[model samples]
Target: MDGKRFQNYEAYFTILDTGEKPITQEWLVSLIENHENNLQYAPDVWREYIKK
Candidate 1:
């Protein structure tokens, strides 16, 4: 994964686990829509994690 993706992953996991200023579903949806292609190329771990 790229450094930017790793950083996003770190930030997402941190917010997910700590429940501190968690991301909103709307924002998440927007991100997905904006990065659909990038996400398709992302690791399986990310795909499965998002499915949860």
Candidate 2:
């Protein structure tokens, strides 16, 4: 992973614990590519992410 995506992964993992569904690398890539900025403050919108 590049620096930005790696940062995102770290930020995401820092904020949320793993749920019933795993947060796999593929999903994180989709999220980073599609909605990178949206998740900077993920605590407010983590549920929306899980659905995607």
Candidate 3:
């Protein structure tokens, strides 16, 4: 992932492991929306991760 653009997003993973915050359905939806919005700038980057 692009570090500068997605630094806080790394917290998504930690939320589950650390239980510091809950990952809500709305947050997941926002994450997908953010990625979709970024597709114009980085389709290849999106495809690379989506394929995995």
Candidate 4:
């Protein structure tokens, strides 16, 4: 993993114990990276990121 995603994963295990807070950018980015690494990055994707 790249440094940014690696840091995010680290924080996920250690610091981000409670997922009650609003999602961090690192987490969001990591999710996208996991789902679709081939896609181009775009800030607009965040507009509908958390729909359940």
TM-score of each: 0.32, 0.30, 0.27, 0.25
Q: Write the per-residue lDDT of candidate 4 for residues 1-52, one digit (tens) a residue.
A: 4545533343343233333446456556856676564223423334345332
Sort the candidates on lDDT, descending order.
2, 1, 3, 4
Residue-wise C-alpha lDDT for candidate 2, range 1-52, written one tens digit per residue: 4545533343334356555655556546657685755454344346665677
Off by over 4 Å in 1: 1-34
| Candidates 2 and 4 compared by TM-score, better number | 2
Question: Which residue pairs in model 2 clash with each other?
Answer: none
Per-residue lDDT of model 1, residues 1-52, tens digit only: 4545433333333323423444446545656676655564444555567788
Predicted structure with the largest lDDT when compared to the true one: 2
| RMSD list, candidates in order | 14.8, 11.3, 16.8, 13.3
Q: Model 2, 41: alpha-carbon shift in Å? A: 17
Off by over 4 Å in 3: 1-16, 35-52
Candidate 3 collision pairs: none
**How many angstroms is residue 38 displaced in model 2 relative to the true structure, after the best TM-score fit?**
8.8
Candidate 4, position 5, lDDT: 50
Worst 10 contiguous positions by lDDT, candidate 4: 38-47
Candidate 1 local distance difference test against the native: 0.51
Q: Which scores higher on lDDT, 1 or 2?
A: 2
Reference-based lDDT, residue 27, model 1: 49
